[model samples]
Target: MRLRLRRFRPRTGPHEHRVVQPLHPLRHASLRDPDPIGHLLADHDGLNRLAGLFSFAAYSRHTVVHIPLRDGVPPDEGMGELVDLVLVHHSYGLRPSQWPGLRRRLTHGTPLTVRTDEARTARDAAAWQARAHRADRRDELRHTTHARTFFLFGSRDVFAEAADSFAYAAGNGPLHKRVQQGDLALVSAIPGLRQPPGGGHPFEVLICFKPYPPYAHFKRPGR
Candidate 1:
């Protein structure tokens, strides 16, 4: 599900390589606090402003989110305000009376919890590309990883360390839809981003305001 969005055009020698996200400053803003969940919601009002888009429906857990393209505002404007990836909870367990083919993935046992950490592996260009496709697939073949991380999780022990090798599952698609996860962040695709209340130079900018830090699937340095 590739959504036709706008992008930024370079003005000089080479194209700028500045990447941004939807949930950033807020991530470290309250780093001294305890509640990771609360820290995740510091500037949630920005995300809440997009309630009409995200939700937690299926999956081993019902955690869902919806990404909204502010009408005529192009992705470059809302990049940091939202993410470009997600976990694969879409076609999971389903009840015959509810969603037959999708109700068996999470059998209603103990709610699963995911543990997140800074992905050092991503710093390696080769490693980053090896797992790039699965990190934050807003689409099947389109990708870009700048400020990504490693989202680790497990079932039996919600607090246990993450699985040996984990990845960000893909979602339905990125056009006219809602909710997803990945090394996703809301960065301004184009240079001049102008959204409500926070429009400025660079045309637009990704405000680093996500539930988790962007997860880079890892790639080769100069890829």
Candidate 2:
């Protein structure tokens, strides 16, 4: 993706200042032979299969797929053939009956910010360590924990900017503050029992926004 520099002003601060930041263009990966999951997310038949798997807990409800942008393409400027469907499982903190209302509000689009700081990282590490001691659902926990770390820290810059932008738009309120309390999850596709016959894994990397406290299953033992 072409890196474009734009001047951005802070929306919530004592003093407004202009900063030139690079806007990263994001797009879906190719849906060709090598990437079966891409094809799965792009077609109706595949979505039906995915829905079935979700019903069986094959995937998490908080999942959101991400794909690298095509090189040299601007986000607003069309992606041409690289454009494809993305699955966003935004079932966190809501009942099945409430999904329709949320969907309607997000029909056009919404800003999603991922924020991480020293405190947030420490909390995540503590949570991971807590999960490590448990034997229940060990394999699933291990995969998700490792994948979450890899995706978040590996692309730290991108996420940082995203968080800043979100804060600017939505205000840094209590709602946004929960992100620092360990509400994010990343589940990347890996080779596992769920692999399809065509080769690639049946799922894409998922960025999940989970509920806080009692609703969230993964938490430190005492808390």
Q: Which candidate is the best by lDDT?
A: 2
Q: In model 1, what is the error at residue 3, expressed in angstroms?
A: 29
lDDT assessment of candidate 1:
0.22
What lDDT tens digits, residue by residue, belong to model 1 across residues 91-183?
Answer: 332122321222222222232222232232223323333433564522111112112211211121111111111111111111111112322
Q: Write the per-residue lDDT of candidate 2 for residues 1-223, one digit (tens) a residue.
A: 1123333333222533222212333221122212233211111122222222222121223432322222322222112233322222323322233323332332233333322243443343344445444556222211111111111111222222222222222221223334346433222222121223475555433322222333344333233
> For candidate 2, what is the total of clashing residue pairs?
1
Off by over 4 Å in 2: 1-25, 28-92, 107-115, 136-223
lDDT of each: 0.22, 0.27
Candidate 2: residue 31 Cα off by (Å): 11
Clashes of each: 66, 1
Residue 105's C-alpha lDDT in candidate 2? Answer: 35
Candidate with the greatest TM-score versus the true structure: 2
Residue 43 C-alpha lDDT in model 1: 24
